[model samples]
Target: MLRHLIARFVFLLAAICAPVLATPAMAATDVSTPWTDEDFASLRLISAQTQTGSSDTLRLGLEFELQPEWKIYWRSAGDAGFPPQLDWTGSQNVGDANILWPAPHRFSIFGLETFGYKNHVILPIDVAIPDRTQSVAINLDVDYLVCSDICIPAAATFALDIPANGNPDTSTSGASTVSTHAHEIEKFVSKVPLTGDNLPIQVSNVFATKDGDATQLHLSVDGLSNAGVTVDDILVESPLRIGFGAPVAVNKDGESNNRHFTVPVFGLNADQDLASETVTVTVIAGPLAIEQSRTVANGPTDASAQGEPLGADTMAPATGAGANIWLIGLFALFGGLILNVMPCVLPVLSIKVMSAINARDGEISRVRSGFLASAAGIITSFWLIAAVLIAIKLAGGSIGWGIQFQQPLFLTVMTIILALFALNMWGLFEINGSDNLGTAANDVINQQEKGGRHLSSHFMTGMFATLLATPCSAPFLGTAVGFALAGSSFDIIWIFTLLGVGLATPYLAIALQPRLAHALPKPGRWMSVVKAVLGLALVGTAIWLLSILAVQIGLGGAIAVGVGLVLGAVFVWARKRSQNLRPRFVFTALAVTGFLVALFAPGFSKPPAPSSVSTAATGPLDWQTFAPETIPALIADGKTVFVDVTAEWCVSCQVNKKLVLETAELAEFFANDDIILMQADWTRPDPEIADYLASYGRYGIPFNAVFGPNAPKGVLLSELLSRDAVLDAIKDARSTAGLASN
Candidate 1:
């Protein structure tokens, strides 16, 4: 019995030791295939004999040892070359496999750029095991392209097997199995780009502009300067079929702590629009690198353009030429006086006329008080605008006239305000002192004379008038605003103050000579007819605002908002018609609710689908959507280009388009095959269009520029367009093109 027990124990021990002795031999046997072309690179598959922790997942690596001067492509191969691909269809017990890519270097060949690794690279592969009890076998068929003077395609098949239960340390028998390459794996693992939540570097602003046939992108990197790092190069990756050139550093006058880089983008498909596309920019500084993605806009925002002000250098030429500051002020004054006749301001000006008419029979002192208050309000509003422009300039941002119209929130709020004003004018409800001049004068005469609210009401009317005048750029107003915005903070304040004084001159004159009001007819039923007519004008303005909103939100959303306004107006009328206070209060509450619904309904809807008319077809004379690169290409092809930078909010732009550019004669002249007409609609905020406008040292709209072979830089037109001016510009451009050709 003793002998039998000893023999049984020995048999059990041998059975366990037998597998352990053979495990080393399995681990030592190479599972990697020989390199097909060792002169370029050597490929292999490596894995660990023992699994780490309690996880059923195994870590493997696709290792490549590249020879000197040979390289492999990254996931985004800048201008050319294909990234490495792996096929694992011939594997077993592998649930999924993912290859991790490391940060790559930018290689510039001639003018073309590429991103890849030049030295030995190891792509760590994570293999998932569905059943840990069963052994895992991985068979990888790799296809990769290596390049030097030329690119060469290479392929190889690698097989790796992991044992279910293997002791890595004690495996002495050289069995064919997995072994640890943890040191090599960990070295390259650190090279992989950091992801998931915390990133070291941040990209603050990215702006793109058209540079001839290429796109110039400016990237502002934050914290790079504080860290004492220099950006060696940058790589831009886009889904569109475009190519990128090498990145160059941009130096600004007063900004040193911030790093700015400009990279040239090439090969943009003329048939596609870049407004909705996104680009990923990777900045590689010494010992540090960061990758960020941003949507491609026309140009950078005020925050992005802070370090570099728009038209700063261009304005230098004007200042150096001894431009008269007083002359500019006089021009601003004339522009402000003429602003009263502009279509956009005419509706609001009707309120001022009503004030004068209502004050005809009132006390002379009261008339003087109301007109003076209105003048004060205009000047104060202008000062406020000046303050905002100065503040933006101090912060290193670009400032343009009527930039508030670029904001969708501003547009939406203004629309609602105009609608409510129209409703009040139509007698749906009456604000205490806002109904008309007669009501306001009565409130002033009957209420506390010292603390009357009518003065503030009249003042607000003046402010509102100034606000309405912003979207229309008058002749002298454009030049004055451009010069003021481009000048120092003090200059901005001074010029704007003059502009306000000019706008308020009419009211001030009436206030000084109270007899002006005495000449007007007395307040009677006729005044009601005049008020109704002005109310209709306000309603027309409201409708135009809705049309602008339709471009951003959608036609459906705009219609919903219009319906809500009508419903709210109905409830307001019900409130006024109610016989009892309780019924009236209930109707008022319902009206408020309806108004709230209308105000927010557009936020819930998706943006409208872009019109097919803008994207359908292309012809030389067919008005193509404005793109920066389009101008240079057209000029290069020996064609004359006419660019119209207009917006729906710009009343002046509409008038010019209808009366001059779209006329039969003008259209026929532009119909020539060698003439290209491009329209850059600025109904919404477009940074690229802003930048293009800045390049000409002009900020106001209804801007036209003609580019031909001779005037390759471009010849700018005035804020107001005329038939003669358009024809003369076209003729000059053609003459210049002919001269250049000769």
Candidate 2:
């Protein structure tokens, strides 16, 4: 038993260690530097002189010229990297060099979002130059990283002279450039339409609605009723995730007395129901930007609340910490029971039950041995799974469930198993009866396949079927495993053990029943038909597996899968057609050719997807994606960051996604520079990503850590989150990042 366990353990280890080969087209060596050779990668200062009587009137600026295609870190760089650091020490007669960031873009990389600049970006700084000084020299030192395929450290010292007698005309270049970039950045950052004093717009009402499966935010503006005056720019600041699925045009022509606007929340799918809650909206009209905080009726609000909207802040408080171990264990047990219904486990159960039906007349010892052998297979398979997970975690791979299936090779293996099983069921190969078969007629006939009687075969079958079951995790299983993954090692073992036992219970019950062996059906012609049907089912499943090949490898590569299948079928057919020695030679040649083709399939030899592509964005973030590094930078520049780490297989993750992450307040909070929200997808295990989570002292998903100026270390949120909770975090992070106290 120990040897068997060791062998299984070794195989599991090997599977995890196997390289995910990269194709030449997708493979590239890591660059030595994150900065472009020609770029001024750190901070620069630009100042504009204001009119007279303005005691030290000058707008100071922090300009960052990032390399083309490469980016500098944001306040929160998401899963990795640090935000840019700037210090201003050497200065004459300057009270403080306050940095004013125009806005930042959300940058998505390797399944994480960060807010920062790509190409060249300049953040304008506003400084009140004291009039008493004849001349002012502003000296600043900046440290930051420039990243392309890899990151490189960069720093620069900048000093700018402000002439006490210089003409306002001399400041055109600095003034114009700063103004232009600020407007450009704002264009991208403005998701929630804010109505500050700069925009002459007033919100009469703000409503939240569920449009089919998506949540949407509707706005009614009071001052928008004027004719000839239009609402050209509409940005939202609320946390109800909202975006335009189609192109949106805001033309303020001042014709109507009131105007209503609606935007669909991005990333939120159909996994949740809408609820009533207080919300806020930011409206940007002609020359004013108005921010209106109000309590909107929650969960599909009615039209009665329109125009009478009470402006109030209704942000929800974030849930602190997490549930205890016992709660998680209960969730795990329920998850285990649900695993019994997964399609992946169903077939294996069918095979076992069928075996039991056939061996009705076998001795208690033989029947018990078969049952024990199957049970052993289930347990052993789970051990192998746990071992692989543990090994990968040790190897710095923060992998989650179903991540292996993302690889084409694993899918190919599944395809091969289903195909082989189908062919066998079709009676392409036959064997003599097993020595252990009882006197039952049905047992005698079907047990002819002595190869399946081997303990190893039963074990392999259990393991293989479990692999198939990885994709369809029951709701209970997801929460259980999710909790286990986030908890202590002891919890992981016990939770997983409970699941294994749950899966093996049926087989155990039949094994313990000795007299049940006499119930086997008689061997008859109907048996052949049943086997043929099973064969067809297997073949159908194989085809389904083949169909998924197109998602990872393009259509041409999927065609290769079909060709490989045909080649394998031909080889099988050729073997069946041959009876003579010369024919055997032809059959052997065909089989070898088929084997080579299967091994050489183009999809099998490719490298795993790059570390830059994140599959977690319900779809994909807008072109302007953000990172974690942007958080500190935004805070330093006075902005908030909302961090979300989620996964596809995690049902709870999805539920929260539809509920909070995709809400307008949240999405707009992310879209605006006021608060930068970035998502880290833990759907697939990447070593770099694993290292990232470990840095946070977490080993699993649904983890949220929010950072603000007030709370730099970040407040860890509970596994289950709500829309209000997210907004409150944003408010806190914003207050902290924006320096509310100082």
Number of the top TM-score candidate: 1
Question: What's the number of clashes in each of the models?
Answer: 13, 93
lDDT of 2 at 29: 20
Across residues 527-610, which tens digit of lDDT does each residue of candidate 2 receive? 778777767777776666665555555556656776876787777767766676566567657755764565458446443353
Candidates in order have lDDT scores of 0.69, 0.53
How does each model score on TM-score? 0.54, 0.44
| Model 1 TM-score, all chains together | 0.54
Model 2: runs farther than 4 Å from truth? 1-330, 347-350, 430-454, 514-520, 602-742
Model 1 accuracy (lDDT, Cα): 0.69
Across 586-679, the per-residue lDDT of candidate 1 in tens digits comes to: 8878877877777787678677654523331222336776765657777888888888887778899878877777778887878777788888
Lowest lDDT block of 10, candidate 2 = 313-322
Q: Which candidate tops lDDT?
A: 1
